[model samples]
Target: MEWYDKKTYIEVYPPKEFSFYECIAFLSRSSQEVLHQIKDGSIYKLLKIEDSLVLCRIRYEENAIKVDFPDRQPEKEGCSLVAKFIWEWFDLEADLKEFYQLASNDGILKGIAKSYSGLRIMCIPDLFEALVWAVLGQQINLTFAYTLKKRFVERFGESLMFAGETYWVFPTYEKIASLQVDDLRELQFTVRKAEYIIGIAEEMVSGNLSKEKLLQKRDFNEVKKSLVSIRGIGDWTANYVMMKCLHDTSSLPIADVGLHNALKNILGLERKPSIEEIKEYAANWSGWEAYATFYLWRSLYDEAI
Candidate 1:
């Protein structure tokens, strides 16, 4: 058992009602996330800000969350950047109480809120990483997707050793965009996937796409259109990026297997809901569709729900 680094405590005050442990549970959904270290109910992650790789440990403490980096003391600007990234990544400012109020009338969402009250959407906070992860998960089981992610990160990402363990940061666009398709071949990337990954990275490196630009869009539809215009991005991928990366609560990928399975299990249906059926049933969700989907996805792990 790993524990928090008490010698280097830094405090982060959340703007809205927050639950540190609940957020960790959401981030822990995938073991393939190499960038984070979760130990003894606290979460640690290596954040790459400019040229510095800052290692942070986060846990609940009083009204504000506590963060500590054992290796060094970060500058004020670096600490601010870390706080901003964490705020967005955990959606600390989102008004989930309003979402809960909305869910109160819906069947599935009501149960979801009751089961996981303070859970927030965990975001990658990096557009390139989110896009690549969405592509890697296409047409495959999550287990295999995680395997691919672990391999890809270890192959190209930067890392540092802390307390005898290595912490990794995702590869930068500059490094990945310069690579040829042949570079990822040994990782078992389908030729098409390799091309797609490289193509997206190239666009990012060229300033054609970015999280800032995407966030500038007016609505979910506009964001979806912009994302789908990029090669290798389709409806499902676009919706996923919008929901997870952009924090668009209205974005919902109706075709997600987890959504289907979760609905089937919750509603006691013998088969998964059709896209048409989901649309009809989810019509009442309106602006809360993403939360609805998230809660259903959580049902996969939380049996008590």
Candidate 2:
């Protein structure tokens, strides 16, 4: 097992009340009994309380991340900054007004927004990790992708134990880079996924890809272009990462199977639309494409239920 630590401080606006468990529920990647896992003391565990910041440790199967707190309690003055980090990491506090407006303009999107109000964009600071995950998820069901990820993480990640539970941190680029394609395949990843993951790691290690620089770019298209320059990263994978990890509001994944199916069902089309058809349909969404995509995904989820 291995241990890693980081300090996170949240500023509450108007001195809003906070429930630590609520925050954990909002931040978890998986929805299947995630809240129950936290309550059962298997996933996230509170470590210490300090002033306005509450310190905690997040436990996975074999890894742990330590979260430290600030010296003072939250207040209105620091709320936006605190909210930004919290939402970026776990909470969804972006310009909901804009999202609502976009949703209201479309019937399908409106229903999605109403049905899944808690859904929010996620941001991962590690570009390599995001890219690799996207690669692993391609052309496969999310359940299978998650299973592969859980196994890969447990096998390769560093872990730590606090109280009685364990926490895991995603494996570093260096750790994954050292592995061969066969090693990843043994962990349940397809050969294509293994190659893509390693290709991304090698490029990052060799200084061919710089996530920081990409984030600094003002134009989202430029960032997407740069990301796709790496081998095995196509339009869908690149746009997905840009929206989820880079927080680009304009990034829309039109090629996703879920998105296609959702649009087909919502529009009452005779068949699933092609990628070109989805792009043409999304022309009206423009600046709010990410929200549109989110709503489409939600629509699909609602249909499944």
Candidate 3:
């Protein structure tokens, strides 16, 4: 409802405690997506709303974020939707007081949390995009996963040129659902992965799987159960979607390698902890497991955990 003027740029007021640079640091880790850019203390991305694509350039100033559309300004309704998307993408509504206070008491989390203050769990807001990301990252390392995504997006996703740069939008489920395994196999995606991705895309396009439907579940366990029922989606993938897309603060991907490595590095263990050990350690973060996982992952890059 704020910043409704279509003739001018839309401005969003983040929480006073928010840090755009910290969030930019997190986002800048991977530049292969072709959809996002973090440079010169500003963030840029192409967002597809309904049928039209809009390019958004966001810069932080004082206590607010300035959002500008260089090519075309969206209608008031579209502007509102984009504003909400940005808010949710950064988890902007969160008040980290309780999480920070709890972290202060945690031996491992205390230092990591303090070092990465104002770092929220940045999320992939689209359900389809999030699910596809989970499926892509499934048996691969982060670097290879980015390679596959870059190829996939460049090949299938729509693009627009602006100022000698090409910006892309993640391919819609409709486009993916119509493809055969061979179509993706040509792009280096394993046959099994292609099937799994197409299956999930078909589900989303057919009205069977959706963020709105998933959110109807009563609790995290219900959401996890529903997601894991799909092909190629396991407990880890389900928890990932819940935390990153559904905004479940307590979601934990206990089997994530990044999480394991972060824990192993921070705890000074000779080997990665067993699932049982992870469970024991998880008791310290009952209600804030997602934030703990995020900060711990950040430790891998920032080395402050």
TM-score of each: 0.94, 0.75, 0.95
Using alpha carbons, what is the TM-score of model 2?
0.75
Of the two candidates 2 and 3, the one with more favorable lDDT, higher being better, is: 3
What lDDT score goes with residue 174 in model 3? 94
Residue 96 local lDDT, model 3: 80
RMSD of each candidate? Answer: 2.1, 7.7, 3.2
Best first by TM-score, ranked = 3, 1, 2
Residue 34 shift from truth in candidate 1, angstroms: 1.2
List candidate 1 segments past 4 Å from native: 1-8, 15-17, 303-305
lDDT scores of the candidates, listed in order: 0.84, 0.64, 0.87
Cα error of candidate 3 at position 147, Å: 0.6
lDDT of 2 by residue, 1-305 (tens): 32443334333331122224433444443553211135343234222122233223333222222232222233444444334444455324456567767777776677766655545554554577678778878988877887887787778865545456555556678788889999998987878889888888888888778777887777887898888888899999999888877778788887788888888898899999987887787787777788688657655654555
lDDT of 2 at 250: 82
- Looking at model 2, residue 303 earns an lDDT score of 53
- Residues 101-189 of candidate 1 have per-residue lDDT tens digits of 88898887778777887788887788889999999999988888888888999999998888898998888888999999999888998
Output the worst ten-in-a-row residue range by lDDT, candidate 2: 45-54
